[model samples]
Target: MTLTLTQTAAEAVKQIVARVPQAEDGGVRIRDTGAPSGFELSVAPDPEPQDTIVVTDGARVFLDEVAAASLEDRILDAELAQDGSVRFALGSQV
Candidate 1:
């Protein structure tokens, strides 16, 4: 359930969290849906049992139970599309 934060994603998450209330408790969750590409990332209010990485600010990022038991390494990257949309990608380092 290791997660990497790209400069773009870290900056964006920092900005968005700053604007929203209760964001201090919320975080971005990354998980592998067992897809062919790699993994899928989801944004939600913390994690229960289905979350991979529970990111809390720039201080700490961790792997949830499920994800930790599954993937060993993962990278969270940010991409800027031609349509002016920013997207996130998660891939297994293994």
Candidate 2:
């Protein structure tokens, strides 16, 4: 299992963490929501116990075991909308 982040995504995450007071020393965490058959992404103060940590371009991404498996061989990217909002995109690695 692996998690990859694009340069833009890493920059975006860093910017967000800088703005969010509670996430100063934190990183992004991805977890699987088994019941809903989906994933949840949020900022965490640090990696939880037994989390898989992936560092990319200075951004730390923490993934639970399920999330790690789910996102294997995938890349995470960031896109900016016309309104300046950031949107995260996940794609399979080619």
Q: Taking the tens digit of each residue's C-alpha lDDT, what string does model 1 give over 1-94?
A: 3556666767556554454566565655555566677555444556655545434347223355555666456565667566655676666665
**Best candidate according to lDDT:** 2
Q: Rate the local accuracy (lDDT) of all candidates.
A: 0.55, 0.85
Model 1 misses residue 58 by how many Å? 3.0
* Per-residue lDDT over 9-94 for candidate 2, one digit per residue giving the tens place of the 0 to 100 score: 88877776776798897888889988664788888889999999998878888999999988999999998667756788899998
lDDT of 2 at 87: 83
Check candidate 2 and list the clashing pairs: none
Residue range with the least summed lDDT across 10 consecutive positions in model 1: 53-62
Angstrom error of the Cα, residue 88, model 2: value is 0.7
Count of backbone clashes, every candidate in sequence: 0, 0
Model 1 clash tally, residue pairs: 0
**What stretches of model 1 exceed 4 Å from their correct place?**
15-24, 49-66, 69-71, 80-84, 90-94
Clash pairs detected, candidate 1: none
- Candidate 2 structure lDDT: 0.85
